[model samples]
Target: MTARAMTQHTEKLADKWGAHFPAAELEVLAAAGYGARMGFGERPALLVVDVTYSFCGTSPMPVLDAVRANRRSCGAWAWEAVGSMRRLIDAARTAQLPVVYSTMLDPGDAAYEPGLWGAKNARGKEDSPAPAAGPRRDNDVVDDIRPAPGDLVVAKGKPSIFHGTNLLDHLIARGVDSLIICGGTSSGCVYASAVDGFSHNLKVTVVRDACFDRVETPHWASLLDIDMKYGDVIGIDEAVAHLGGLTCRVS
Candidate 1:
């Protein structure tokens, strides 16, 4: 194995024990390819992940307030991100590009849903509790940003959008070679999706203004890791410019 891969593996091991482990430098090797000035061909799609009720608002693990606090004068950062995401969605529509939405599948078994286990694990109660009935369609994407008739919504089983889903196939079918990823849990789902997107050869750009997490540290760290390694980390305005370039066919 390469020396960098060994370092990553070691970090993963240390992280498992609640230690302060850093991201492996191996990921940074892919960053240069997706920077602002790169040849990301046409057919770019906006991918929104897990923008659902369960993860937002007060459905247990709500960090909207924390994110809002971090944004300062803009008021609510989470709210702002969602608004920017909506605008990006509109831009994709105008460009006739695909908009792919992803959400956690109805986790029928409580034992399998980490979010559910999140409560129990956080409480430190010993006995493993039985799984609760998975959420129905009502628990789908948050009503504010739910897909319309023609939009594509994929149900996934994990944090990574590509895991156990046809996201890549769908993107390929639409001739999408670039991905503008948005949505929640920056350190978790967003980062996981970017890692897999790069592995699959899709040029990835993460809109920092459109992603959120339960904590500031992970959110900031994930952005740093992604910018330094997995993909292009651009602000919302820069992403808008790039998308505009795609339309005008500029560089």
Candidate 2:
């Protein structure tokens, strides 16, 4: 679909579900000091969450096939957001800021372990049934914006990157006080990471256009909720501009 048509389609979904908050509500919240800006910090890092083929469908995999069967998949939208994310990544790299990535890698034998959230969410399935035979590297990051040398790549099993990873310690060690997050699905991993970042006292900025969700309403709702309570939901250009405004640093 054309970009204009896709936007109109998303708007229709948002309107139908009341996903867009009323302007009056926002005004009242602002008056109540609820949506106050925290602004960017001296040291900021880019946290790209779950830009993997399993979610984006950049490659064929059993998980992708199942997700596609659900009809609620947003693979196309996720693919669309990739360019914007690349721009943010490039800007962050140029500013000499740390770039971190989170991927939900295959858990191998742990796939059979009970209480796996992804498995539990699979309509109560014990595990995602792999294809009878095919390539299975669905957890790999999309090639266009894969992590480069010197970039931190964390393999996480849960939706929130910080839940079972050393992401927090790494950020603290790097002196990062702010986080710029982008990836898919917005209402899932992105939302979880943003909330965790807020809870950690880190200033969080979510690049809205650089994030995608399996469904449009939840995407809009999640962004609104994050903007109001957890972090600022901004556009890609605004994020890149902020990075560009940073002083050049010796790498």
Candidate 3:
């Protein structure tokens, strides 16, 4: 495929790396063979990485406003990405593809150690007052795109879904050689998944519109990095088309 053919991020007219990387620097990377497409795989599966209320907050609002509900909240873009994810999920389901979701174990759970997370981040865990938004389901996946019946769910500790989780086993069991990934915190979980998925030799494809982050910078940066070295960061429509092309095969 052409270099620009695989360059369709949700940023519209802007190039994913154009704003951040200087033209001369980007040219150097291109000369060094950095931004070529890794292409898609044969057998594909959808991996929804961390679309929980922690990242999405209680509802659609500004990032700062939603962060009141939960400091991890990424705000409005998270919900928008959720909408895209829902459509992608519907397309995948219609194509009879396996759908897998990854979420964090509950904060109260014995296995849910926040580690440096609780110490560093300002999520009201310290002597700070509780959020004005009241009780929130920090770990549960968002209702806008909850897992359907027969979908696989994995609770993970690390950023990468494949780390210390049975995600690899599930993918191997279903003969999933390609991953169409979506969901929140693109610079965090989604980027980590793309890297690990690539490390596992799986064809990783991250849906640009179907992923979000705390802000635009890291979000686009991670997608650019994933596209450069790890996976194909593509548009939601392309992802839907890819899944739809899988035929009437059973999940």
Candidate 4:
């Protein structure tokens, strides 16, 4: 789909969540500096969180089947998001910015390996009946925007990529001061990553159209919350334009 179509789709999904906070309230928060924009920095990185087959269902997998069976799948919206995310990824690549992809790894086939999250997703746990010691097939990055030759892929065991991962160190080593983040389950991994990025003193920008969630309400709510405090929530077009501008200035 075209970028315009993707954006319209996102807006329509947000509309399903009913009314948002009043304009007056939003203005008040803005005046109080709650929604300040954390614009891009000289050094930025694209962080794609959990854009895996299990989340977007671009490929058939046992986990995808389970998600559909339980009526908790965001495949419809997530599949739409893939196009926009691809545009952003292409932009980042053209600019030669660091690109990182994160996928959730099942610690083991044991029930408690995923800890609290495993319990929360009891039906959708990553642990397959077969004893596997490594990442599952469904956990691989989606084909449309799979990691390129130099792209860093981090296997995370938690919602936040920073948890038990070298993501922060990697960013620091690359001198990444700003993060352009996108990916699945907007209310979960994306939200957690944005919050952690902010706490770590990095500028965070969330591509609103490039993130998806199983439910609309939490997705919209999380975007609003992140825009208010953690970072800026912008459309994919804006993100691409920003990356293009960065490339121009660098060149």
Clash count, predicted structure 3: 0
Q: lDDT order of candidates, best first?
A: 3, 4, 2, 1
What is the per-residue lDDT of model 4 for residues 1-251, given as tens digits with 9 covering 90 to 100? 56675455444434432276555555445445565556877899999999886677643334446376433346667878889999999999999999999987743424225557656665655446453335535677888898999999988878898988899999999889989999978999999999999999999999999999876789888988898789988898889998998777565
User: Which stretches in model 3 have alpha-carbon errors above 4 Å?
Assistant: 1-20, 124-136, 248-251
TM-score comparison, 3 vs 4, better candidate: 3
Best by lDDT, which number?
3
What TM-score does each of the candidates earn? Answer: 0.68, 0.80, 0.87, 0.81
Model 2: residues >4 Å from true position, as ranges? Answer: 1-19, 59-66, 69-73, 109-136
What overall lDDT, based on C-alpha atoms, would model 1 receive against the true structure? 0.66
Clashes of each: 2, 0, 0, 0
Task: Give one digit per residue, the lDDT tens place, for model 2 in 20-98.
Answer: 6665555455444454456887899999988876677753334456475432235677778889999999999889899
Q: Can you write out model 1's per-residue Cα lDDT over 149-211, one digit (the tens) per residue?
A: 778998776779998788888887877888889987788888999889989888788888889
Off by over 4 Å in 4: 1-19, 24-28, 59-66, 70-72, 107-112, 122-126, 129-136, 249-251
Worst 10 residues of 4 by lDDT: 9-18
Give the TM-score (vs. native) of candidate 4. 0.81
Worst 10 residues of 1 by lDDT: 66-75
Best by TM-score: 3
Residue 239 of model 3: what lDDT? 84
The RMSD (Cα, Å) of candidate 3 is: 4.4
